[model samples]
Target: MTDLLMNPTVARLTSRSLLGRKRTLLLSLLPLALLSLCTLARILGSLDDDIAGQLQGSLSADLLSTFGFAIMMPLLGLIAGTGSIGPEIDEGSIVYLLAKPLNRYTIVVTKLLVAIGVVTAFGALPVLAAGVILTGELGEIAVAFAIGAFAAGVGYAAVFLLLAVITRNAVVVGLIYALIWESLVGGLVPGAQTLSIQQWATAIIEKTLGYEAQLLFVESAVDFSTGLLALVGVTLVATAYAGRRLQTIRLHDES
Candidate 1:
């Protein structure tokens, strides 16, 4: 299994899919937009203490939660996760690999690793950079949010990878969950926050930054323990399930 996971062909395929022309362009856009926004804000000379506080307290927070985690991370994960398999499935090209003697689970794990890497690069790194730009590492907020983004990206990639295996509309489902469930319901309904990845991730950031900061960002329905457990559990389960699903996956006919 380890050998299969390390297969050069698998790595090659993963890299090609992740770095393909269209997807690469799409992935680059988010980080570029974030940096541009931060630069614009800086150039506008709106760095009054009050404004800086608001930028850190509200604007940066919203960007991390709404744009970074909710919009960008999930979208990137969907593209990476599903793109790892969806195109092969769609074009019936997966049969070439499946017919070989490689272990199915190995393939899944390799693809998951690639997806996780892609999400971290395109999603987490920008969040960290943006946080730094927003507050110059005040209270280690940048590091804290970056760590939260890392954890969230891992879970997001795993969940979306499973969704890709189980359904054709994985991207749509991921978008709905990221946008409607995490953003809308998680905000409007207090209880829904526990079930939200955004809240769980925010809880991590809160804990890392101390109680006051935690209280500021995380209105999670679940306690820290619950949120951590759910995040870890869901990621592991999704990866395992995706592996099992791949083992039995049937290739569709091109004809």
Candidate 2:
């Protein structure tokens, strides 16, 4: 089962390629920006204790939930996920890997795993750090949003990775989804929130913080049950479909 799910060689190669200097720099930019924002907010807040107190409450939560979860997480997921395999496919290097005696599903899973790790490290961890920087403590706001960031990271990675498998223009398509569907539409339209990964992850933060989430107005458009179900469902279904897509690509190449 483990062998079917992962290939060490594939994982190593995927990590090497994905974390090449250019990709690493791209991934680092967002997190650095996030932390810098948090630091600036904190510095400004320290000017007045009253301002600091107010900033620590709603402003901190907003930074963590709004910018961190809604914006940075999905964008990081898009970069890491698409970068994991899109370059190989685009450069026609995937054929070399596919020609080997390996399960296509295993290949997909291995790359997905690497993408998830990258998202977790670059996306989720930065949210956690930003939370601490903004809140100045490891409180409910920090912890809860950190967890939410992680959940969103997982969903985004899977969805974007699948997008890469299906389209050479995955980055452009993913930016539309991340910026349009998840950001603008999801934020403004109540009805569309049900279909949003950001809302689902916000639901998790709402659930984890419970009453505290309410105090900061950290609410999700969807309920916790719906959010959890959608998160798991999207990840599984997208990953399975990506494997199938890879198989089709292989058959076409053989022909």
Estimated TM-score per prediction? 0.89, 0.96
RMSD, one per candidate, in order: 2.4, 1.9
Kindly list the per-residue Cα lDDT of model 2 for residues 99-161, writing each as its tens digit.
Answer: 999999999999999999999889888888888888889888888888999899999999999
Best by TM-score: 2
Off by over 4 Å in 2: 250-255
The top-ranked prediction according to lDDT is 2
User: In angstroms, how far off is 213's CA in candidate 2?
Assistant: 1.0
Assess candidate 1 and give its TM-score to the true structure.
0.89
